[model samples]
Target chain A: MSEHGERSAPGKGLVNGLAVTLKTMTRRSTTQQYPDVQPELPPRSRGVIALLEENCTVCMLCARECPDWCIYIDSHKEEVVVPGAARARQRNVLDRFDIDFSLCMYCGICIEVCPFDALHWSPEFEYSELDVLDLLHDKDRLGAWMPTVPPPPAHDVLGEPSKEEATAARKAAGPGAPTAARTARARPETPEPGK
Target chain B: MPLWLDLLVRVVAVVAAFLVLPLLVGQAEHKVMAHMQGRLGPMYAGAFHGWAQLVADGVKFVQKEDITPRDADRRVFQLAPVVALFPYLIVLLAIPLGPGGLVAQPLDVGLFFVLAVLGIGVVAVLMSAWASANKYSLLGGLRGAAQLLGYELPLVLAAASVAMAAGTLSLPGIVEAWSPWWLLWQAPAALVFFVSGLAEIRRPPFDMPIADSELVFGYMTEYTGLRFAFFLLAEYVGIIVIAALTTVLFLGGWHGPAAEHLGWLWTLLKVFAVSFVIIWLRVSYPRLREDQLQRLCWLVLVPVALAQLVLTAAVKVAL
Candidate 1:
């Protein structure tokens, strides 16, 4: 058996050597021309932070959850009417929200723990700046949408049928029925005491 | 111009050829090897598949830092690259590139002159090793000396066969006598010459002295930046010299169709072809064991070379 192993050694070695050479020849090169071709980062790629301003409820959850304390939020009380109520209710209005991305580790825990879906990961990685303070993204900078987002995966599109139906219904209804779907989707069984 | 002035012009022409042409040949070798292995090489460096890569590399190397080890023998460390580099340049003075392409007075003792000049490169390796004061460097230097000594005998014997057959040591004289190319006629001697040449240059399957993995870059472990680049340049230059010598002695030194008008072109093509094979062998084969390398030189190559030399002499006397 040992003699057989010795006899086959040279043959195996030749094959192994050729395999390595061929693999190196065919492998995709790791080098990238950074200034020329921008890399296509994935959907969840942690590059920078963006916010959905309309959906934010001023809960300050993102700021509270942030490990680095990079997120800063200030809010004030605002009147919001309860559904079918005569009197208005007081709630907190978000006055400021800022994220200093220079100090941010991009752990995505803030995004994950955000109840209002206000905080999101954006794929714009190129953010070089001369001033160290310029990298500190304030409320205005973080509020706008990123230019491009990787298209949602196929399974996500398939899973959200109501959203697709609502989009189709909106297209059919023309511009007149802006809030028709939301009104129709609201439950009527629960009654209000005063109206 | 006086005779001395004429000689100086010839020396300049030879130096230019040695310095410039080998770089072009090395570039061609890279492209050919890339094609054979199924890829495009250096397609963007210049207009045509990085033809100017060597030029770019040369500029970069010169602009790089010239570093020396703090503990090194500074004078010898600085001198090593110059010593390594100049011998290959001198060897090119003796090589006959083609008809009317003889650079200097073609000596009757051209073969011996080529060997003696090329042998000086080993001294550079030794100097680098000892001057660095590193154990691995010393081992590499010792290995280089032993390897060169072992291989040089077979290489000389192989060349002696061609000299004996042609009844001359002058390179142009040897080429002038070959009605058919000498390589085909003296097949055994050509084989011995090529194998020994590979060993002499320490190219792979015989690159024991500078085995990068085992010895951490061998004798050149301490050399960095421009000094290392010089050693690299000398290696490729040495490859070109060996290929040129092989062409002159065995492959009929530029004798081909259109013998006058296109002789230099044919000579360059042949030399480039041989150099490609050497580079291909480097990429294809793994390095041999040090003991195996020594054994192969002494046991196999020297005996084959000796036999060919004896056979060539006997045939010459009979003819």
Candidate 2:
């Protein structure tokens, strides 16, 4: 027998017997109580999709890259001639851009591929439905801004600033100012138009 | 009430206490670990630090779909958790938690009865492992059986020493004999008993059978839903029972500072204190390797327990 074996052998029976009790007494647990204190998800976690309609240029890029084929876009071409332009330019009018979120895997590829920076991840994960089709988000439904994902509470066990403090700090810094370095670091590189 | 009705009531009491106490202790273990590790534990489930978290977990387990592997022995796999759980309940019947705390006839062989019943839990573990027909489960089951065999001798020896010192196998009678407490007279036996008890439960350092990293829950590998929950419940219940047993055997069952005057509260406090110590040890140490585990039990614990037994006999003859 090995030194560890020899040393622990006579005592092996006792230790083996006490092992379970010792474990119950020891070991890091896996449970996190969610109702009284919400668990903190990591930064850049893809939860739900929120459309930033103001930033949308009706580019239909999100619809094209979606692997799930959940996004639906319908457009009509309208010709408008500029007074000084040599030729008339055709701008596609966005008639419909419906994203059926029911099929969305939250891969964020659509958000990444959107040239207009229209799609963003919303932190709300509590969406529940009686019907499957209720999750099928249409153009008008997708255009609405989701509720701001609650910032990590100050007392949060996962170690992030509370939502109130983060919001207050952001407000102090000015509207749309970078809230934290971590969040700023996660920002995707904006795509150039007409690529 | 009629004899059968009274027996039914006692059974219900034992079952209820066994179920509830483990949940409380499990929560306390989490809270204690969190405090020791410089973090607050379970502050969210209900009002005070996720007190209702276990209830939520129980509800979730009930709601989950109980799934069995297609290749598994369905009857045995389903029966395993019940087997694992039932022994703890049976063991609880013999435990004298306080002066009037026992739910069953306090047998002259109470100490042996608890140990014997606890042994059955290992069998359940083996059954589950074999029934699951999974490699991990088989390994886990095998480890559990081997572990029990290795640990039981020392555990029995330690209990025998305590029994010899107390001059009775009846748990209540033993408690009655200790003027100050049995632990003071039999410190060595207490130490051996505690160490062996920890092993018997397959606790940390020796928790190789269900080591999640290696075995992925061992015997419970193929179990899902409520079946998995039952296994977990059995483990926690086992922890509580061991702690309770420790309190009863050596710590002077319900005897504390003015315990007689304070009534059952003193007993509760003593049990809680013992339970907390068990939890504290878990937070303080990391796990031991498997071979190291086997060696430690056989080499160190067995000799120490035997020595204690011999010394107790010598002391008894001298007295």
Candidate 3:
């Protein structure tokens, strides 16, 4: 009993506690009954790391920034044939990208440091594995989580439009508007030949 | 019936009760405690409110590795669980569930026998404590012994007051002598006996010996597997024994409406109701500290028990 508990008439607190528990016993339990009923997680809830493979430039920024060194990346430089260029330009082609989820602290550093906007947070968390080694999610497996990734929540303060959105807005304004590329920073070129 | 056959039947009945009632109380505790805390306790095991949860626990306990400490007195350490478990089995025999020779073994001095046998639990605590060669175990054992010693006086005194009111020590005889007015007359002694009985069984508020926070399960720290399971079974059996005894002694055992035909039912209902109260008390009160435990036993319970004794004596003489 605390000092306050002592000041109440002796045994009154004991009776009151018993009454509280008895009353609680009659009320509906607050249990969520997980597995039977899915939880109502917020839209941007960080359940797992998802990958947008098409957006990855094989920059290795995410791998370098990962504190746990759980991320693995492998890429080889390939010559790209431009439609009308004198010299062929070289670009990094992604071969392998895997995240060892067993070692991941889920610090979001990998997602934050990715300049290509490849990594995203997905709310589909129920991917438990029987073996620890199986937790290492390859790029294909990570990409599978992309469909479950919810769109980013609307900003609390709608301050600055993203370059893509701003470019779209300019294009909509007039036919003689400045080209979208000049209006915004230069767009990163896609390495793949087919659209 | 042949005497041997009769004895065998009674023994079997007692043994079956000894095995079953404790499990029921344990399951009740699991559900009751959960609901009281606003949680759906166990939902998965039996597919129906976790009815087989304790059954699964029993299987798990059996599958666990029985570890014996290398430095421990292996013989005494192993024997402790048996000692802890068997006294309640013996005490259960004399508890009359209803009228007309309904008891398993109707002893003339059933109250004395029950009280004396229940005292052996402290020996079990001491055995496990000293045998484990752990300092915490020893401290818990010492605390258990001290608590039991302090509270035993009131427990016995309260029972004795009831014995005086009935003018007999036979449980069924006491029940036969009981009247509804005894509810008001013996209320104080009933309160003392029930509380002291809680202390005897080391139930919470009175559970200083096994203070998990301070003592790491006290005398049971080194126990594992089936040996540990035995100790848990012993605790549930202790609850049943206490509830049954409180029912038999104070609540007029099987004396209720339609008790002639449903005497045993009345006894069982009373026992389960008392057992629920025991669980409620555990849920309600934080454990009393050691000094508070002693003070409650000596200053409060003992005096109340003594006063009930005097009142019973005076009423008996005047009537």
Best by DockQ: 3
Least accurate stretch of 10 residues (summed lDDT) in model 1 chain B? B32-41
List model 1's recovered fraction of native interface contacts, to 2 decimals.
Answer: 0.03
Evaluate model 1: give its TM-score: 0.75
Overall local distance difference test of candidate 2? 0.77
* Position B309, candidate 1: lDDT: 82
Q: List the candidate numbers ranked by TM-score, top first.
A: 3, 1, 2
Which candidate should be chosen as best, given TM-score against the real structure?
3
Over A1-195, each residue of candidate 2 has an lDDT whose tens digit, in order, gives 345655555646546645654554356555565664677877656767777666666776777788989988777889999899999998777777676767888888998897776777766666667898888776566656445544433574444455566667777767766655446356534321111
Residues B127-179, candidate 2, lDDT per residue (tens digit)? 99999989999998899898888888888998888888889998887776666
**DockQ for each numbered candidate:** 0.08, 0.04, 0.67
**RMSD versus native structure for model 3:** 6.9
Q: Place model 1 in a CAPRI quality band.
A: incorrect
Give the per-residue lDDT of model 3 (tens digit) for B117-173. Answer: 999998999999999999999999999999988889999999999999999999899
- TM of chain B vs. native, candidate 2: 0.94
Question: What are the iRMS values of all candidates?
Answer: 5.0, 7.2, 0.5
Question: What RMSD does each model have against the real structure?
Answer: 8.1, 10.8, 6.9
lDDT of each: 0.79, 0.77, 0.91
True contacts kept of each: 0.03, 0.00, 0.94
Output the number of the lDDT-best candidate: 3
Off by over 4 Å in 2: A1-195, B100-103, B181-184
Q: TM-score of each model's B chain?
A: 0.93, 0.94, 0.99
